[model samples]
Target: MLEIKNLHASVLDIDDSEILKGIDLKVGKGEVHAIMGPNGSGKSTLANVLMGRFDYVVTEGDVLIDGNSILKLRPDQRAHLGMFLAFQYPAEIPGVRPWQFLKAALDSKADANGEDKMSVRNFSKLFDEKIEAVGINPNLVKRSLNEGFSGGEKKRNEMLQLEVLQPSLAILDETDSGLDVDALRIVAEGVNSMRSPERSFVVVTHYQRLLNYITPDVVHILVKGKIVKTGGPELALEVEKDGYKQYMAEAEVNA
Candidate 1:
């Protein structure tokens, strides 16, 4: 349902700062793909570019969702198109509670799609259900969004949003970072529960720990801003055993 064609991007205000180089990927509906790479391999850059982050300029390439280009759309516009990016470092909104933030987001998406917003009572019911399913404390969500929340709490909150937003394609950028064993399990469960025949996920992670819980149909090795190897789940195991040294050596040689 998502396609990236020769995707090249560079950071704004930096000379010769291109990060992603010629990234081409195709994720069909119901599929799960994992991107694993060393630091500065442009994993997060790809995520931000796909979501239309303004700080990064797409020097070349086109991103298509269901065959239509979204290069000109803003981040929110892409959200309305069923694209969701769970940040590696989720931002804390100091004054807004999760309930308020999510309600307004749902309303906005509903309005955009010419659908009626859910009533407060129904919304509350669903919200409570989701928060529980995602293993988030209801009391914590009542507080300002992500403010004073622990790392695991922030990741759970992201999953709660995913559950409520129900995006067609969810790009989770290092969702497992800073999470402990329990927290990782909770987050993985949240993602696992959301998997379905009509939805897809692009999980970008550095290690194979998260992959143990959520097995991906495909695994890609990204190095030096390019995807150099693509394989099945076995590739992740190989990376875990041998590390990315070989991949990095290959990438450098190719470069």
Candidate 2:
């Protein structure tokens, strides 16, 4: 459902700081792929570039969703195309409550996709159901979007958004970061519940702890902006055991 073709991207302000170098990947419908690498291996960069973030420029290659190019589309347009990105550091919108933020986002996506906007009554019912499913305290959501929320709460908040939005392709960039055992398990359960035949996921993370609960169909070792190795779930265990030292050394020499 998602394809990245020889993608190359670099920081817009610096000419020499190329982050992604010829990344080629294909994720099929219903597949879950895990991308594991060391710090600064361009994992988060890939996520940001896919969303058409303005800070980075794609110098070569293309990103296609269901055979259509999303390279030139804006971030909102990409969201409308069923691409959702759970940020590593989810931004805090202090003035907006979760209810208001989500309703507007759903309406915007509906208008962009030519779908009918969800009525308040229906949205309220669904929102309440998801809030409970994600184990979020209703009072917390009423406060502000990621405002004054603890680390675990923010992660659960992302899961709540995912459950409510139900995007086609979900790219989770280090959602497991800063999460404790219980919080991590809750987030993984949230992701597991969302898996389906029509939905795909690309989870970018540094550790394999999250992978234990959400077993991925494919595991990729991305080093120095390139995917150097691809394998089954066992690859993650290998990374856990041997670490990324060998891969990092090899990639730095070649990449």
Candidate 3:
């Protein structure tokens, strides 16, 4: 459902150096792919570039959803096309209530797709259902988005967004970071419940703990901006045991 073809990207207007050397990946419909890598491996950069974040420029290659390029699309435009990215560090938007933020997101997506607008009454009902399913406190929705929320709470908020939006493809960039065991399980359960034939997930994580709950169909070892290895869930276990040291050294030597 998603494919990255020799993607080469660099920090926008900052350097001519490429963070992504040549990333080639293909994720099938309903498949979950986990990208495991060390810090500075450009794992999050791939996620941001896929979302069309303006600060990172794609120097070469293309990111496509169902065979169409999304390189030039705005982030919101990508969202409208059922693409979602759960950031590693979620921003705290003061004064924006979760209810207002989510409702507006739904409305904007609907309008962009020329679909019927959702009424507040309907949205509230749907939101409440998702809140219960995702185990988010209903009271949390009344507060500003992620403002003063604990780390787990922020991850839960992101899962809630995923549940409500039901994107075709979800790219989670280290959502397990900073989460305790309980919070991690909660987040994993939330993701597990959403798995379906119509959905795909690209989970980028530094550890294999999250994969214990949500087993991916494929695991990729990303090093120095390139995907050096791809395997099944066993690959993650190997990573957990042996770590990314070998991958790092090999990637550097090849560079």
Candidate 4:
């Protein structure tokens, strides 16, 4: 459902320090892919580039969703095209309540698809159901979005968005970070519940703890902006046991 071909991206403000040299990846429907790497491996950069973040410029290649090139599309345009990103660190909107924020996003998506807006009653019903499913208190929805929320709560809120929006492709950028074991399990369960033949997920993580809950179909090792290894779930175990030392050594040799 998503394809990246020889993608190269770099920050435009500096001397154009290249982050992603050439990232080529393909994720099909119903597939779960995990990108594991050390710091400065361009894992987060790839996510931002896919979302068309302004700080980074794509110097070469293309990112295609389905069959269309999405490089020219704005961030909102990418979202409208069934792409969703759960950021590693969710932003805090102090004044916006959870319901209001979600309703606005959902309405914008509906309007983009030429569909009628969701009725207040229907939205309330679905919202409550989603909140309960994610183990969030209904009263929390009335509070400001992610303002003073615990790390786990923010992660759950992200999953709540995933549950409501149900985007075709979801890129979860370290959603498991800072989560306690119980909270991590809850978030992982929420993500696992969304698996389907029509949906796909790309999970970027540093540890294999999250992978224990969500088994990925393909595991890719990214070192120095390139995917150095691709394998099954066993690859995650190897990383967890031996760390990325071998991978880093290989990368140094290649460089």
Candidate ordering by lDDT (highest first): 2, 1, 3, 4
Q: Residue 152 CA error for candidate 1 (Å)?
A: 0.4
Candidate 2 contains a number of clashing pairs equal to: 0
Pairs that collide, model 1: none
- Give one clash count per candidate, in the order shown: 0, 0, 0, 0
What lDDT score goes with residue 157 in model 1?
Answer: 95
State in Å the error of residue 118, model 3: 1.1
- Cα lDDT of candidate 4 equals 0.93
Q: What lDDT tens digits, residue by residue, belong to model 4 across residues 108-213?
A: 9899889999998999899999999999866777888998898988999999999999999999998989999999999889889999999999999999999999
lDDT string for model 2 (1-255, tens) is 999999999999897999899999999999999999999999999999998899999999999999999998999999999999998899988989999899999999999888999999999999999999999999999997999999999999999999999999999999999999999999999999999999999999999999999999999999989999999999999999999999988887895
Q: Give the lDDT of residue 84 in candidate 1.
A: 98
- Estimate, for each residue in 143-173, the C-alpha lDDT of model 1 and write its tens digit: 9999999999999999999999999999999
Candidate 1 positional error at 187, Å? 1.1
For model 1, the superposed segments whose C-alpha errors exceed 4 Å read none
How many clashing residue pairs, candidate 4?
Answer: 0
